[model samples]
Target: MSIASSAFLATIPSPDRGVWEIGPFSLRAYALCIIVGIVVAIWLGERRWQARGGTKGTIIDIAVWAAPMGLIGGRLYHVITDNQLYFGEGRDPVRALYIWEGGLGIWGAIALGAVGAWIACRRRGIPLPAVADAVAPGIVIAQAVGRLGNYFNQELYGGPTDLPWGLEIYRRVSPDNPAVEDPLGGVAINDVPVEVVHPTFLYELLWNLGVALLIIWLDRRLRLGHGRVFALYVAGYTAGRFWIEIMRTDPANEILGQRVNVWVSVLVFLGAVVYFVLARAKGPREEPETLRSPDDPDYPDSGDGGAAGSPSGTAESDTAESGTAASGDGDAGTGDAEAGGPATRPGSASSDVDTGDDGAATENTASTENTASAESAPAAGDPGAGGPPEKPGSST
Candidate 1:
């Protein structure tokens, strides 16, 4: 056999599936890794949420809004970037919404998912930066899982290498495919048509997970806030992506044999660096916005006051001023009518006169007090005298 044959022989993947068939379905490592990654992301996010002084319910609230958005965003990203794959002959772009078939771009997912999370956080009255920080590590871990998905799909591999740790091609991509190879000169393997590339997916997975662990550990020890850890995550993951992009043999339009993602990684890494520098220079401080107490007048007690009833019961309390019961009674039908009656209205003729600290001074009493005075004195027999008043006179 020729040297090319020997090289090709070394690059076959070791089929290592436990081969457990659950009835009619098959569970693969790729699916398992992705699921585990999502679970881990949620766990990490919840922990970070609490650390940032968020309510326990915040995670559930956020997930309710974010999960679907992220998934949809990710699918959309995949469809747009690889439009030909989904829009080609006999293909239904609508089916592109089907995520179970599995095509997601990390960048697209992150970008759109971040928006979803921001809206959710805003709705929950949580600070956006704090939410961003909580999500940072999880995103990295999720990317790690996503890379494993690439491995299962047998795509996104790199150039050939003789290294002991080099990935073997369980499945090879065609050079004719624009996605797997660039339009170029002839290159054959083992005197046969084959393109065995590096397993870039696994490399990315391990690196991202490693970076995530590092960020999490450092966050606990350092107590960095304002998404510093997350910024570091972006920086670190981009750094790894940069390195892997160099080794990637996937069909890509490369400027100087470096893929477009390589340049993107550089730009992203620089951004992350700038962010980290600014964050450190500013000296990490807790965002004042996140520091809200239950008693805070402006603090949102529950769902937007647009709900049927405000949780603070301010509406009910205000109603109490109108003769309604001030207690926690839930009744409103008979109570309102009774409370509105003259019998319940204070200072009314039928009710006890309202007295201040001084004394009761009703409308009539006030008018009488204004008229009476010492100067205008009435004599004892003023009625028979025909004079209204006399100065110090008691005789008639």
Candidate 2:
């Protein structure tokens, strides 16, 4: 191993626990880290949501729904995994609900939190998959900080190895057995020896940090489909956890002498691959048309589907003008010569058609109008003798 790695492994310094002790109640580093992570994630998500042309209040609206669900999911995961410790032997199972004591599962948090977020997005009409992509990197980074909390507790370490990087474990007398001292100075149990194990928490912290960086880099460089980056995160973390679980003495189940987490890693990795492939086949999700700036002359305003400069308004105006002129000409043509004589006609006393012949023409037009009125009758108040309502909405 390199010098830095050797030093990190040989003597990993236990991080200091920054606590605020107010009488009996004590605030801890773990809680603070989680809160900071959540705040930062929400801020970032909000900024991205606005940048993407989403509604003004979408982020805050969604967070109101998603936050509580995430907390519940995280606690539920811990309870399910370590039920034996919480529920058995006269233990108050209600204490399991006390999340301040630090019991949360990342898997459950992500899964159920996603459900909550999805619901929120649906309510707001925001695209759920796109929001997932925006939040993925932030979630991984928060997880990295959470791991440091584990470090302060001096928990979640791995197996022993003389690689000059092994964390020292100072042995202590157990409450039940006060007559044993381990070589590595671990807490003794019934006069038995137990050495200090590896710090898996630190390993996970560093791993998650690296993964977070990788995700940010990929997102910036490539236009990945929605939810793909989050899938990769799941697969990546699961793979790392699988390896670390092998080196640790945790009571997580095993399959074929290997930790059950290993199989989970494999399955998650495969799932990521499958999800990406299917998503590509289905094509990209349709995005809504983004409106230009309000100040732009081309921007749509009240009572219009498009900008004033657009062709729709102009076309409608032109059609109205033409229709009005056509209707007026038709009306004039049906009148007698005395009202408005036609300038051209054979056998006329004046250059215009004779009033008698014009009257006869008017009578014929009135008869024809009554016959065709069945098909194109005007609305309520009968004004002109039968023609389509002088082309309604036409400008005079």
Candidate 3:
């Protein structure tokens, strides 16, 4: 192939359509991408939470609240920021509710979605920070996946470019009515070129994936807790979004000659940084045992009768065994005294029995010692015994 032709061929082409009609229903690619992203995030979050000693299905439980609230928050942010699109003289306000058409703000989603998560966490008696830390990487990966929706919708592109990898922007119109332009709900009609532009959405998707990996690596290495991992994720994401947001040619609200999102990115990044630094006082990653609240069904009780397989439970079992052995020794010692024979200590079979004048006293003393040994066995077996009580974990 000729060099010019090869270069042109290498350019990325936009999808001809972002929606499909199946029977009487219209399925939107943007909505499918969002749903897929949510599923992936939940799946990954559950695994990560379990790895961090959280109960299974906790992520799903939290998502029941977070997901819906997040969607609402994202849509609200988009509408309020770009009010001109819906509330202008010729625009229709009802279209603001059409989320499938695309437009969600990460900042607002995180802000309000956190409120929902906080409610679920409180109800479950789990620390919100712990859950946030566990799901940090998953959230970033979900964002990356969601960016595919923007690409299919033929939005969020940057200024025109001649680069070999530049994205080809197609002129789309309604299939049934060619005169009516429907950028988000139309099909490309010709093979002729209009203009190739910088694929900003692709750039963001790649960046988000890189951030997810970075967060995972840093979290594993540092054993981040107290929401430090989440803070790191926010900082990392905002850093990338700041630059990517600047590259987009899409119409958006601006503040002080710069896009409002750029300002939001700067503010959010600083907030994340501050939180990450302050969280150091919380010490290292929490012990799995300490993460659960006493009210949690899965919590290990350390009372007189502890939960099965717990340290206190093990100690109690060991104590019972020790007491049984002591009782057997006591019976043997009594039998020897009654038969006018020398009494031997337990586990001292080879040694000569006590036949001295103090024989009765020795048997009594040995019996007392055996009782003491039984009492001390539990303490020896349980490492946490007599230590300070464990404090219950709390959330912000």
Candidate 4:
């Protein structure tokens, strides 16, 4: 197809160039897209994790391990699955290490990235399932963003299409050697068009974003935890991937006349669904206190209630002091009565009795002793001696 005809067809044009040369450095849009996606994933994961009662910087710390491992894992999957592209008789095997050229398998990236996350979780004394649940939405969003790289690279397109949203594929040639057709290290020239194809990358990008929103909504509504959110994400992504994988026209290894990814997606989706259902037995979301390490400053101690400086301990001490003071006052009143003197109650005017004769003083002392004895008597059949009254038949 000619550029003039494609321009009149209302199709999405592919990027004219995916790389830029600046003096001594080269910048590839694919790499930039990947970097931007990683940053977005980390920022979003940190926010979600903190909201879920995780430590503030825990996501960032885990990303330091997961991101690198994910990249390596993605590259390895691509090379191993498409071994013919790198290990063929005429192909350069070194090209397998050129990740900037664009090709990352999401399945491999997730599988190996989880290993890195597990290691980080273990070191920080955090549960891996909680971390996975917190970051599931962010991971899907990152995948959506990374799909833009596939757009710029003019790769992962489907068979020819006449739809309005069809992607225009322009022939690319090496900038230094115009005669050499180099898709990865080349730039489109002469405004020419080769074909217009279905934008499968765009389809997957939109599907991924939709799945992210779905996961977030379900997570909030159902309060999913213990890796259920992550499991749901996996199931949702693979469901879309199963259809999208079959639509792609790219050369790939096949099993039973079907693409290998289609088979992988089916198995993974079943596994995720099973895990999601069985995970219900794990109980509800973890509380904030349980998410913290024992050494954390805000961590709740087991001995908090009776600690010396704690509120409950201070209250107990005050009650004991008050009881001792009351007992001392009771003993003083008894001693004064026994010595044949009127026992003057502290804060009572009636205690100021006339002591002109010994008989009057003896009478006052005897009356005080009788009143004290009556006031000190317990209720009938009370279990506690001189204690507060209780209703009949009530247990202590």
Candidate 5:
């Protein structure tokens, strides 16, 4: 007898099916969820990137490389860790190629996706740290959305529970081979037509959302930079993943009496913490106005554009032009000081008299003029010059 009538509990219910087939095309909820998450991440990341002074279209371009790389990496990690699905004697090896059915590891996705992002960023000359900081919160929220796919797929839930908001799960039949039951257990038939399980996916979704908010708040308050905000995102996500992994009853590989993911979470979290501390000591937030990617040296650092190799690019030229103009002086301080010394001394008599800090420059100007005039003055009684003007007709 089915257990549907044996129990009554207030709880969240898992979707009946996550796959939809139309005519010749099949649309999967899992894949759709992942796609939506990626789109949202890019949209949010672009906004944040622009706010950080990064050029538009940069995020979209990077995503072109990153998204595919992440999918491949995520699938690779899942297949490698769960090789039984393909590598075992009775298991079909080609089944590993079918990614739409579900399974993607977050760690592998991040690690390999970084490689693609680095390649794209190098081409654009945008600093990876700056991009990472901008994209961190968006990435977390994307993970939150990805968890919804798991709920739809009826996967990754925890042990039986009777909580008010517990997830009511159903028996899941394998999409690949209907003859075999899903290796990952579903709700016990004895428990009910629907049995409540701890909604581990939902817990993770909420956790990721919370972590994203925490990062945004901290980024604003402390002004974290040098990829520290990204590191914090990693640490924060892994911290939650550790506890959540423990609650999950899924048959993950074991290491030292814990799930493989648990160990990964701990190690990654520690590395993130260490990196955050070290990176902060490296520097403050980058001045966004002058941001230049590694490959684009010709990018201007000031208002008046100049080729990096040109003399005009040097600070001196720009200062002479803009700084002098802004100060309303044709000749900047040094040039004017030299030329107008004698002329200026007569106008500001106190300029010569005063010897305090402010007046020191004026005193120096007057002294310089006096020295020049003395050197040019006629020697004592020599012919046409000094002692007395000779009587015009007399040859002294």
Candidate 6:
């Protein structure tokens, strides 16, 4: 085909390169996309987590562990299930570990990521189901963003199409063996002058976005909790994956004549549906745990589910605020402790006593008897102040 003919097709073109080098470091579009997706997930998760009474750092901290585990799980699932691609007679087994080349199973990632998250949640004394419910929508949004990596990799696209929205795949050639045909097709697409295929990645991306919106909307409207929201997310995502996986023309393992992923999606969707239904009977919504960072004053710590005040002992802690703290009054004036202790007011510190009975010095003590007697005493000029002046004669 002529260059003018190719230009007339007007299709989305794949990136010329998926990786670039700067200094000694190599940056890969696929890896960058995953990293950005994880970051977005963590940011959004943090908001939802806070709404659920979780602390600020919980989402990021859990992600730190979940991301690597998910990556490993995804790669493990891909290599193990699709071993033929890398472990085939002529293929190099080492390439199986080349995750930057783009092959991650969402099912495996979620499963393993949840395990990692559970560990983090356990350490923080948080329930895993609660955390799962909060982050469900954000997780799907991250998956949506991850599809961009497939776009750059020029992989996981659908069959040939002539539509205006088709994705233009560059000529795929077998460098090691020119005789080898493209795994996606029986024929050598490299010989073809031009190849335009359906942009299945975009299809899945849009679907994931829709799923994310649906999960969020349902979560808010239904007040879904106790992991039901997470179940809904699983169901919604698998529903989309079932259809999208069918559209993809990439090389995938087949089981019972259909893609193994399609079966997995069906199984997963059923599990999610059952869980969502059963969870409804358990409760409508989870009580957001009032338990949060004990140190974070701004974070909520009350079980009341309202604007939280101070820590757990806040109301009770006012005991000290109401009055000056009780301590031995050592000195006549301030009673402040010197190097040894409060500068003793003569014999006062010996047994919680006060040297002088003037209401001034006695007030420093925690004693009830002295405080009451001092209060009863009247001024010198008052009737009761002199205590019957003639009574002094009888006592003498």
Clashes of each: 4, 9, 0, 0, 2, 3
What C-alpha root-mean-square deviation, in Å, does candidate 3 show against the real structure? Answer: 8.4
Stretches of candidate 6 off by over 4 Å are 1-8, 172-193, 290-396
- Sliding window of 10 residues with minimal summed lDDT for model 1: 181-190
Candidate 3 Cα outliers beyond 4 Å, as residue runs: 1-7, 293-297, 302-304, 307-396
Summarize candidate 4's per-residue lDDT along 1-396 as a digit string, tens digits.
875974746988888888889998889999998999889889988998888777788899999889999999999999998999999799999999999999898888998999999999888888889999989988999999999999888898899998899899999899999999977668998555688899999999999999999999999899999999999999999999999999999999999999989999999999999999999999988766456554455544323321222212344433232222123223322333333333333343443442322334432234656457434433222233444433322212
Q: In candidate 2, residue 376 scores what lDDT?
A: 43
Question: How do these models rank on lDDT, best leading?
Answer: 3, 4, 5, 6, 1, 2
* Predicted structure 2: lDDT: 0.58
Q: What would the C-alpha RMSD of candidate 2 be, to one decimal place?
A: 12.0
lDDT for each residue of candidate 6 in 79-185, tens digit (9 for 90 to 100): 88898989867999998888887889888899999999989887876667878988888889899889998877778889988788888776554434656643321
Off by over 4 Å in 5: 1-6, 173-194, 290-396
Query: What's the C-alpha lDDT at position 204 in model 1?
Result: 89
Ranking according to TM-score, highest score first: 3, 4, 5, 6, 2, 1
Which digits, one per residue and each the tens of the lDDT, describe model 5 over residues 297-360?
4344333333232222454434433333113122222233333232222223433322222335
**Candidate 2: worst 10 consecutive residues by lDDT?**
345-354
Tens-place lDDT digits, model 2, residues 272-353:
7788667666455323222123343434342342323322335544333333221333333333233233322112232222
4 against 5, candidate with superior lDDT:
4
TM-score, candidate 1, is: 0.60
Model 1: lDDT of residue 103: 67
On TM-score, the stronger of 2 and 5 is 5
Encode model 1's per-residue lDDT on 3-37: one tens digit a residue: 75566565555232212346778555555666777
Model 2: clashing residue pairs?
A: 9-165, 10-164, 10-165, 157-198, 157-200, 158-198, 170-185, 171-185, 171-186
Regions more than 4 Å wrong, model 4: 1-9, 302-396
Residue range 70-148, candidate 3, lDDT tens digits? 9999999999999999997999999999999999988888889999999999988788999998878888888998999
